[model samples]
Target: MRTLQVELGERSYPIYIGAGILDSIGELCAKHGISKKSPHLIVTDDKVGPHYLDSVVSRLKSEGYHVLTHVVPSGESSKSLDVYEQVMTTAIQAKLDRSSAVFALGGGVVGDLAGFVAATYMRGITFVQIPTTILAHDSSVGGKVAVNHPLAKNMIGAFHQPVMVLYDVDTLKSLPAREVSSGLAEMVKHGLILDKDFAYWCCENGHKLLALDAETLIHGLERGCAIKADVVSKDEREGGLRAILNLGHTIGHAIEAVGGYGRFLHGEAIAIGMAGSAMLAERLGRDESLYGETIRMLKAVNLPVQLPQDVSIDQIMDAMQHDKKFTEGQMVFIVPEAIGSVSIVKDVPVEAVRSVVEQLKGEG
Candidate 1:
């Protein structure tokens, strides 16, 4: 097992990544000071519940922790106010208290929803993340939790860090091909924004990652998590330096909103957004090669570098207008200055953004 720390002083936490570590969850919770006397809630989804819910419940119960499980239908749609209320109802009915902790037992959706519940329940409670999807490597670490508003992705959210993140690589083995590709987009984003060599390494090892090679996958996940941990530790509230983490999120969130949160997975939308960011970089005369390099890296993992033909540019623009990143009357963008660096440029002209979106749609 490999352990990484998100050093936030009093609020710091550990991230444990390994194969079959789910078996040790109960013991880990005990070690972390979670109360066995209090009722705990485990929020998952229909897809993850059948595979791991029973085992997780059994483990916690064996440790004398009163466990409650609530499974919602899987997908982006589950991250909604409606589901949040339903889970809150479950928690209320279960009589969860401040001493209780919420365990997120699925992918990013479960983590986001469960974390949001923990953040708002009784004004805040402890939460743990057990990420089962590759895309979750990004969402599970940062305390950024939210439910989507109709106008924008993650419009309703908070920065509530987890007590711990338990990642069992075994869970990733069951992911679908498209999901794998989607997850790689975030992994690649980590390198793209912070590590030049790592970015190139991702491209070179793309095939091994896609095949789920044990050593390569774990190493990549660790690096990705470490980068995120380092950033979150320094700028816990995204006051500065942390916005770099949103390298593709500006355009990406808009894509998800315009698509109604059902069309493209989060990472897929981010992939297109990153590609668009690179193009915007060139348009701003930063580096012409950035676009090609980013395209190569994204293509290495089979991520979409272009917007879908049917998605309307005007709709995407309207979605961006509602994005939290949109400041004043200008669009904020994370434009790549190089393969491994980005600049958070504000007040980007609307026409330039439209031009980039048009170009993205024109891509074959």
Candidate 2:
């Protein structure tokens, strides 16, 4: 097992990554100071419940911990206020208290929903993340929890860090082909924003990663998580240095909102958004090669680099207008300055963004 730390001083936490670590969750909980005397809630989804929920529940119960389970239907739609309220209702009836902790037992959706519950329940409680999807390697680490507002993705959210993050690589083996591609998009983003060699390394190892080779997959996930941990540790509140993490999120979140949170997965939307950011950089006359390089890296892992023709540019623009990143009538963008660096440009013109979106649609 490999352990990484999110050093926030008093609020710091540890991230444990390994194969078959789910069995040790109960012991880990006790080690992390989670009290067995309190009733705990485990929030998961229909898809994940059948596979690992029983084992998780059994493990916690064996350790003398009182457990409650709330399973929601899987997908982006579950991250809604309606569903959030339903889970809260369960928590209230179960009488979960401040000493209790919430365990997120599925993918990003479960993590976000459960974490939001933990954050707001009784004005905040402890939460743990057990991410089953590779795409969650990003979402599970950072404390950015939220339910969609229909108008924008993650519009209603908070920065509540987890007490610990338990990642069992075994969970990733069950992912479908498209999901694997979607997850790697964030791994690629990590490289693009911070590590040049790792960016190209991802491209070179695309086939191995897609095949789910144990060594390569774990290495990639560890690197991705480490990069995220390093960033969140320095700028816990996204005051300054942390905005770099939004490299593709500005356009990506808009795509999810315009799609009604159903068409593309989060990472897929971010893939196209990253491509658009590179193109935006080119439009600003930084470096023409950046676009081609970004596209190559995305294609290496089989991610979409262009917007679908059916998605209206006007609708995308309207969605961006509602994005939290949009302020004072100007679109904020994290434009790529190079393969491994980005600039948070706050005064981006609306027409330039439209031109880039149009150009993306024109790509074959």
lDDT, each prediction: 0.91, 0.90
Q: In model 2, what lDDT does residue 357 have? A: 86
Off by over 4 Å in 1: 324-329
Model 1, 1-364: lDDT tens digits are 9998889898889999988899999999999999988999999999999999999999989988899999999988899999999999999999999999999998999999999999999999999999998889999987999998765567799989899999999888889999999999999999999999999999999999999887788888989999988888889888988999888887888898787777888889999999999989998999889999999999999999999789999898887777655665667788899998888888788788889989999942
Candidate 2 Cα lDDT to native: 0.90
Error in Å for residue 243 of model 2? 1.4
Superposed Cα deviation of residue 142, candidate 1 (Å):
1.8
lDDT of 1: 0.91
lDDT of 2 by residue, 271-334 (tens): 9999999999998988989999999999999999899889998898888887756666677899
Worst-scoring 10-residue span by lDDT in model 1: 322-331
